[model samples]
Target: MTKEISFIDLGLSEEILNALNDLGFTKPSPIQAECIPLLLEGNDVLGMAQTGSGKTAAFSIPFLMNIDVNLKAPQLLVLAPTRELAIQVADACAEYSKYVKGVKVLALYGGQRYDVQLRALKQGPQIVVGTPGRLLDHLNRKTLDLSNLKGLVLDEADEMLRMGFIDDVESIMATIPEEHQTALFSATMPAPIRRITKRFMHNPKEVQIKGTKQTAPDIDQSYWLVRGMRKNEAIVRFLEAEDFDAAIIFVRTKTATLEVAEVLEKHGYSCAALNGDMTQQLREQTLDRLRNGRLDILIATDVAARGLDVERISLVINYDITLDSESYVHRIGRTGRAGRAGRAILFVDSRERRLLKNIEQTIKKPIPEVALPSKELLEKRRLAKFTQQVQQQLESADLEQYQTLLEQIQAESGTDLETIATALLRLAQRDRPLILPPDPVFKPAREYRDRDGRNGERRLRGDNRESPKRRERRDVGEMDMYRIEIGKENGVEVRHIVGAIANEADISSRYIGNIKLYETYSTVELPKGMPKDILKHFERVRVLNQPMKMSLVAGKSSEGKRGRKSNQPESDDKGFAKKRGRPTAPKF
Candidate 1:
């Protein structure tokens, strides 16, 4: 039988080893064990590993060891796909090099003020981590100097490719010194990544960690089909009935993290939000509080919660469904760690049923659909908890003073002891009543089963009649028609409109209604009362290389406007419509 390798056997420096010990890392993971030695030997390595495979440390440790802190130039550069991931990688590198003197790390990404990055760059940080677009921007502005680079790491290469940053990646790589060592890590290797490795690396060593994509067997997962209630209300009901030590609630956006955290805190849960917008110090403080049991629920996005391992997290709630199956697996993997049993609950919207099926196929297991806790069940649980509190107070608390006061009150008021006790209970539970209130009534969305016994919903086509039930449930009357300047003439299709709206607005396709395509413009029906910020964001969203200059139509419906050829202007020889007097834009 072979023995496992410890961090001590990896031949690391004392400072590095001390930092590892402080972090409580006794043994290296499989990828780390294999890549650390090769990386330290000045070799270009290609590693295949999933998100939580410790690949960050595998490359970080060797890069830190190889850099000469005396020369305060950029020696190690890591390019991640998202701002959240770049910040996480920088945080990890900073932790690993805490004991080493004169070593600094800086993360540069969009949404952060450029002045902050400029000041950090002036400080001569030896390590730089950033997204490819921001990195290219810096390179173009001559703000970053990589003349003496020693090592380069492409973290989550597949994700970078999927996000259309491969061109920016190749452009950045072209400027770097050819003699520098390279380490590329990804979950999957597509053709573009393979081509780059062949062109840039010099006889690279390959390391593949098997089974990283598999979900933990100890996790019991289920989904609650969002029907009759809003997501936040359903979450509160679930928490009222569930018995969990600690949990992490995953959302899709930074704004959502704050919103969900606020809702949970209002319900008297000890929770906090972790997102990329927060400073490094604030993020660390939030995490420390969670670890010390001061907080029980953490609301976060996927990137914010990456590589998080907490033993007390016995539950995970997916407040917003992930776009891909790999992320779904990673979200639930936060729980059920160290062989402890964990429970994961997913909140699925009606429009997301197809995504749910994709997740089931990836895991090769069925996630049973569950209903929200019944009002009766919640009432019983609350009463039981109140009773338990009373029992504990009676057994351990000193009640001699209170008992005398109670007797005096009873004697003066001429009330029985039972009546006084009941009155006191009412006073004690006034802020949080023991009895559950009536749940809000909402009409359930209908679903149609296809020939294959699969549940699905039809998308709104041009002028398709909607059933009265669906119309009332979805509030079709509240939707307003808006015109965009892309249509069949620009090679735009129905799927393009749906995909753009769904991805960019964080809105489900079900909410989008009739889409009519014309020669130069198209109109779509969207729920009214959209926030000004969301409207502003949509203007920047492009479809088929053209901005969706979206504007509200003059009337509520586009029924008559579609066939009004007399009101439409003619097109020029260049296939462009001539300018004409437009209707007054409506107020939001």
Candidate 2:
């Protein structure tokens, strides 16, 4: 039997090893252990590993040691599919090269001013990480010099291909010096990628790390199809309904971590944000609190949550799904450790269904679709918890002083002891409402007919046609009418509008009612109390590859201008009544 190798055994330089120790990395992941030695030997290498298999460290460490700080002019170039991934890769390289002085690492990508990238380029950074499109842009501008480059890396090669940047990637690769060492890392080796390796790489050493793509078998995985409900509200319901000792909710960006954590805390949840922007001290403190139970939720980005091992983290929520399928495995890997049962829940909108399908296929498992918990279910769970807590207090509490006080109050007020006790209970529970009021905007939830007219799972009633009288009576209250620019001419079906609104606004489809499509525009009726930010976000949503151009229709006259009563079935411009029950968007 062979033994596993540690990071120290990979024969890394003292400075690199010291930085690794500071970062608390005692061992290497399989890909890291395999590639580091070959990369150090000055050979072209190709690494195939899942997203979180430590691929960044595998390539970064060896290249960091080999780069010459004195002759710095973009010595090592890393190409990524997106700006986010580019920033992450650059950050990893910078951290690994902390003790190795005079080696500057810069990230160049779109959405930022060219002056910023140009300034960094003039500073003569030894390593550059950027997306294919932006890198080519810099190359064309002559701001970035590839003349002194020593090595090149194509990170997430498959992702770049999927994003239609393969041509740009090939062009950039052709511009780099042919004598430089090259490495390509991707989760999958498609035919194009294989051809690239054969053409550009010279006898490349292939290191394939397998079996890390699947999460723990004990982890129960499921997804919640978010419609018109706010993500925070849905998350709060989950926290209220589920029994979890600890949880980690994953978001896409650093800003999202703080934003989500703030919302959760405002709703009275014990949560903290973990992101790359935090100081090491703050990060350690947040993790310590999570470990000691002072924090119940740790909202984090993918990079911040790397190497996090907390046994009590029995729940993982993918609040914002990542584009990378391997990241899904990494996120859920936080739970179900050490032979313990765990749960992972993903939130997906209707548009991102394709990403969801890719993840399921990559992991080779079907994630069951779980319905959102009803308001009744959440209230029941809260009451049951309150009861358990009261029972525990009664069994162990020292009540002599309270009993005496209750007797004194009873005598003074001539009230029964039970009445005084009930008054005290109400005071204690007054801060948080025990029961949530029903929302009239939403139709009563029950078995809803899918667009196919089959009895599918519960759907919002707005998707179904209501008689004119029923709609007029049901929509009598404060309902706002909004108009969207896309209509029948652009394949603007009713299901498309409902699915987009429900998914984007995090609202349930049932709350969205009375969709009327015309030759050039469509009108939708929703509750009047919509949040401003949600309204703004809804406008930017694209339906059928066209911006919705959603705006308030303004006044009751606009509804009459459309010439449709609340109960009237939707019709085309020619006044042909559409089908009452329309099918929904096709599921991936």
Candidate 3:
């Protein structure tokens, strides 16, 4: 077995070790243990590891220890892919260098004015972290001095490629001194990245830790399908029903943080909004309250929650799904820490299925589906909790004075004590009702389409090898025949009906069965157990610019071979079925 490596084994200075221990970390992760030694030894290193795998510490620890604080001419520089990541890296470095004196770290990213960054650069910080584009801009303006730079780190190199910054990254790296120490870290090493590493480094050491699952196994990740417009209500319903100590709900924009929090507060939930607009003093106080269990829910934007570690957060909700998969991973990582079981819930629309699938593929785990809690289930839970609270209060209470008062009131008013007690209980519970009104049912609206113009079914569509008798009598399997108003008379084609139904009901064409057209109407077969909402939408589908007005065709069930006259068209199988006890298809 491999021996466990502690922070001391990496030969970190006392200041750095003290910072790590203060943060409740004793042992170093595999990548950290492997890369720290080489980084401290002044060797160029290339690391391949997944996000959230202690990659930041692997380089930051050594970069902080080796920097010459007095020179203050950018001794260490880290390039990140996104502004969020830039801030996160800078924050982690600041924490690691807490005990080390005179190590000035500045984060430069876009969105803030250039003048702000220029002012900070004039201070001569020893370490700088920024995005490729922003860093290149600073280099072009000559505001950032790289003459004394000894170490350069490229963080999330593959993410930089995906964000179309590889050329910019190359330009920025080219400006670094030839003899500077370099390190490149990426989740994936594409061909271009490998070529860059070979061209830039001088016999660098490679440390690769295979992509381990970042999401903790203790987290129960789930998603609830909701409409785009009704997301607020859906989230409120979940919060009302689920038992969570504290939660961090993530939104897309800073404005949305306040808006979502206001909605939750309106619905009687204790919530606070955290965003970039807040002052630093206010943000720290908000965080302190959250950590001390005074805050129940916190609505925050992505950037505002960077490096926020709170153990009391038992749940994380993705109110708005992020386009970047890494952001989703980072948002959910706030919970399920320190071996405690946690829950992550994502609210998504039916049209966002592709996004959901992308997240699952990126995380390498399937998030199970969770339905909204029903009214009955919520009521049962509320009643049980109320009963438990009452039981506890009664067990510890001294009821002597209250019992004497109750007897006096009963004697004076000549009314039973139970009646007075019931009235008082009702008054006490008026502010927050134990039983809430039922929430509206959630239904997703999405369409399905097929590439082939045929009836949309994937079955064979070639010349019939069987005789007309055999073709007419073909088994329908376990399918239900339904009638549509559009037919040959309305200039309706098979593709038109297939497209209309597929797009309206969001059902695949493969699920559709045999279709027979008639002069007045048409008939199509579909599988059993279709969703009720989907079926309801199908009745409103328009084919050839007219409502199809579909409905179930009622009749007796037909079995065995269908017998028909030789002269009749094969499409006229409905008549033979009608004569028997079976439901008939539309006549040709």
State the displacement of the C-alpha of residue 307, model 3, in Å, after optimal TM-score superposition.
26
* Model 1: residues with Cα > 4 Å off, grouped in runs: 1-3, 213-218, 222-380, 385-409, 416-419, 426-588
Root-mean-square deviation of each candidate, in angstroms?
15.3, 13.6, 21.3
- lDDT at 488 for candidate 2? 81
Backbone clashes, each candidate: 0, 13, 2
Cα TM-score per model: 0.49, 0.52, 0.49
Please, what are the lDDT tens digits per residue for candidate 3 over residues 1-588? 336888998788999988776553567778888899898888999999876567888899998888887786899999987665676687679878979997878888765456556756776788899887778888998888888889999998987777678898889888888988999999899988998899888899999986545544567899987632256657877886777889999986676787788888888788899887789999999999998888889998776887899988889999887644556787889987777778899987554554576578668888887887777777787778777877887887687888798889889988887898877666656545566665433224434443122122121221111113322232223455678887786666666666565445444444456677888888876654444435665775555435577786632234444623122234434542423222332211
Find the 10 residues in a row with the least total lDDT in model 1.
451-460
lDDT for residue 281 in candidate 3, whole number 0-100: 99
> Against the correct fold, how does model 2 do in TM-score?
0.52
Error of 2 at 311 (Å): 11
> For candidate 2, which ten residues in a row score worst on lDDT?
579-588
Clashes of 3: 2
**What would the per-residue lDDT of candidate 1 be over residues 89-114, giving only the tens digit for each residue?**
88679778989999988888765446
